[model samples]
Target: MTYPKRFAALPEYAFPRLRSLLDHHDPGGDVVHMTIGEPKHAFPSWVGDVLAENTAGFANYPPNDGSPELLGAISDWIKRRYDVGLDLNQIMALNGTREGLFNAAVALCPEETARGERPVVLIPNPFYQVYAVATATVGAEAVFVPATAETGHLPDFASLPPQILNRAEICYMCSPANPQGAVADRDYWAKLIALAEKYDFRIFADECYSEIYRDTPPPGALEVAQEGGADPERVVLFNSLSKRSNLPGLRSGFVAGGPETIRHIRQLRAYAGAPLPLPLQRVAEKVWADEAHVEENRALYREKYKVADEVFAGIDGYMPPDAGFFLWLPVEDGEAAALKLWTETGVRVLPGAYLSRDTDRGNPGKQYIRVAMVAPKQEMRDGLTRLRDCIYA
Candidate 1:
């Protein structure tokens, strides 16, 4: 069988490999799962009621581009959050940002962007799985850029050689970055936007975790791009209701960018993508337009951050995240530390090595573990205390 060569070389999914490593072992104490970044906060009380009101719409087919009402809600949210206005034509409803992140490559990344060479898709070393998969799906060369402690936990794309940048077709960035929780500031976004403009590539900002953070909201990629006056099409920002409203099951997100880029993405979605159902879109509309619930949710995460700080204070190399809800703690070997945490303290965390791949220098995540702060405040504190004592102590 002539299977596709692109995926044949890819590593197995991270979670399945993790399950194989630990599923057979019995936890030594009561289990505390600090692995996946699934938020456990309360969703808006009106979600169910809103869905019920639009239940009849479910029988009808959904528009691929999303209804005008939903689009308006998304646009309004962007305007309020980032102080940037976007036309409805420049936004497309996604079943989830996951869909937009993966599909944008297929729709926007060309077979050969620089003359006659296979274009390169730049990804952070410890990037969302979707980025690498998207690059592979489009038959582009995937270049892993080191985003480690050395680089303040963000990828430095501007440092790449001009040849690679010239062939670059896409760059994936995550703000309030997953696992590390390092938020990219305006300078970072401006620099990246300039690079994208210089190379004629697009930037895919995976900002699903943008809302769950400490202190001020992270600078948005689209807003920074606009401020830098780069070509609007050079940046496509993907955001979702999952983290914002604690509604992962709702599976609602949107892609906003230049009209031409969005038009191409919407055209591709028409043939291969499933839009959010009418009822779900109705709920998404309200969710995006409301900020009170989001503010309350941020306060909850803030409390968790304080808990982590108090628990891990005085420990060596314990960096409180600038934003987001994960702790990428340094250790000698991520896998060994995770197994020890599970066996001794019954606190399960993801080995950082599982989230990253080896590169020319080394796997940047070879000596860390990713602990998600997604439990209730008390439970989260217990988990962090156990983790600190079991590992760092």
Candidate 2:
């Protein structure tokens, strides 16, 4: 049997690969998972009560787009957070970020660029896997740009050759990046938007971790787009309750952009989108409207940040992340380090190479391991101490 050529270049997903590398061995001690950025913190205490009250709505087919109340909540959140107001037509709730991040490419990426060349999707190395899969689904060329320590762990898309930029149609950017946790600054967003304006491409800004920062709130793409007077359609913003409210299981998120761009996305949502269940939608509305829970969640992450800094202090190459919950710690070889850490200390982590692709310059993630800071404070400290004594010490 033959498969589509598009996915032929794609590698196996990350977690299964990690399992293959570590699961066969007996754990050396009490298992402490420092892999997978699944938030172990508590979610809003009211979420259950809200879900119970809205259970009747579950019987009906949920709104194909977000429910009116949910969209209103999302709009108000955007206005409050990004200072970019949006009409009802400009926003749609997603099952979670993965669906929007993938489907938007299917809806928005052109088959061919204006230059009549195959469309190129610029993806940051060590990216959330959905971006590359989305590019493949669209049959576009996926150009993997390095987001290394040298580049401040953000993709330098502006450095790409004119030819690559000219053929580009979509660029996936994650602020408060997943594994590395590097937040894109306002200046970075402005420059990327300008580059998109000049080259005729769209920016897919995934800000799922926007609320999990240590100090200042990260500047958002839409915020910069509006201030710089870039096209309203230039950036498609994706954020969710997953990290912000510790509601990853809630599977609630939204994509917002220009009305025309959103119309195209909503058209696809009508067909292939998995709209959030209506009860979940009601909960999402309530959660989006409230900031108290999010602030409390950020405080927890800030404590984790302090723990990481204190643990890894004086370790060479241990630059702390600006935001998000993962620590991309430097190692001699990611797989070897991860395996040794697991077998010797029972601290499980993901090898950085699993999250990145090999390029002409070689795999940028080859010498690193991504440790999730999502565990409890004391457990994380224990895990980090074991990992350091095992791998780095």
Candidate 3:
């Protein structure tokens, strides 16, 4: 049997690779998982009530794009959060932002540049794996740009050559980034928007971790785009209730952009999409409208942030994340540190190199490990203490 070679270059996903690396080894101590970013917080107490009320709707097929109620709720949230008014047509409900992130490229990335060249898709190194898979699936040249400590953990897309920028169709960026927790400020968004406008490309802003910040809410790409008066189609924003509402299993998210861009996404989704069950859509509608639970959730993460800072304090190269839950701690070698921690301390972490691709300068994540703070406060503290003593000591 033959398989498509499009994905031939991709490595086994981060978790599977991790299992292969450590599952066979006997853990040296009590196990404390600090790997995956899956949030362990309690979701709103009313989710079950809402699901019960809407259970009957499950018998019916959900709207392909989204129920009118769900879309309206998402639009209202966007307006409240970003201060940008958007018609319901400008948004499409997604199973999760991950699904939308991958499919948006299929729906919107042009087959070829206007100059008849294969388009380039810019991705930040140490990126969410979906970006590279999406780029390769679309047959675009995937240009991995470094987002190391030197660059403040955000990719400097403007530094690329004019030739690469000219053929660029999309760039994937995560603010309150996954492993590094760097948030893009207004100036960063403004410059990126200007670059996109000058080069005729779209920006896929993955804001899944946008709600888990420590202090002032991180500025959003959509809000910044509106301020700059850039083409709405040029900035496609993807967000989710996973981090915001502590409802990762709820699998609720949305993609919002200009009407034309959404039209294409909706068209592709109509054929290939699995609409959230009507019951789940009803649950999402209510979830988007409620911020009390979200605020409570953010407060918990804020407390955890303090715990992390206190734990890693006085450790060199320890940068407390500006926002988001992960701590990208510097190490001599990510894989080696992770293996040592797992075997000696039984506190599992993901090697930074697993999240990044190798390039000429070397993989930016090669010398670090990503530690998620989603466990309960005391448990997280205990794990971090063990990790610090076992590795940093």
Candidate 3 residue spans exceeding 4 A from truth: none
lDDT of each model, Cα atoms only?
0.90, 0.93, 0.94
TM-scores for every candidate against the unseen true structure: 0.98, 0.99, 0.99
For residues 1-393, could you state the per-residue lDDT of candidate 1 as single tens digits?
A: 677787987788779877877888888789999998888999999999999999999899997889999999999999998998999999999988899999999999998875999999999989788888888899999999988888999999999999999999898999979878899999889888888887788898889888887778898998898887888788899999988999989999999999999999989998999988999999999999999999999999898888998998898898999888899999999989888888888899999988888888999888999998898889888888888888877
The true-structure Cα RMSD of candidate 1 reads 0.9
TM-score of 1: 0.98
| Model 1 regions more than 4 Å off | none
lDDT of 3 at 173: 90
How many clashes (backbone N, Cα, C below 3 Å) per candidate? 0, 0, 0
**TM-score of the candidate numbered 3?**
0.99
Residue range 241-345, candidate 2, lDDT tens digits: 998988889999999999999999999998887788999999999999999988988988899889889988999999798999999999999999999988888
After aligning candidate 3 to the native by TM-score, how far in Å is the CA of 106 from where it should be? 0.5
Model 1 per-residue lDDT at 250: 91
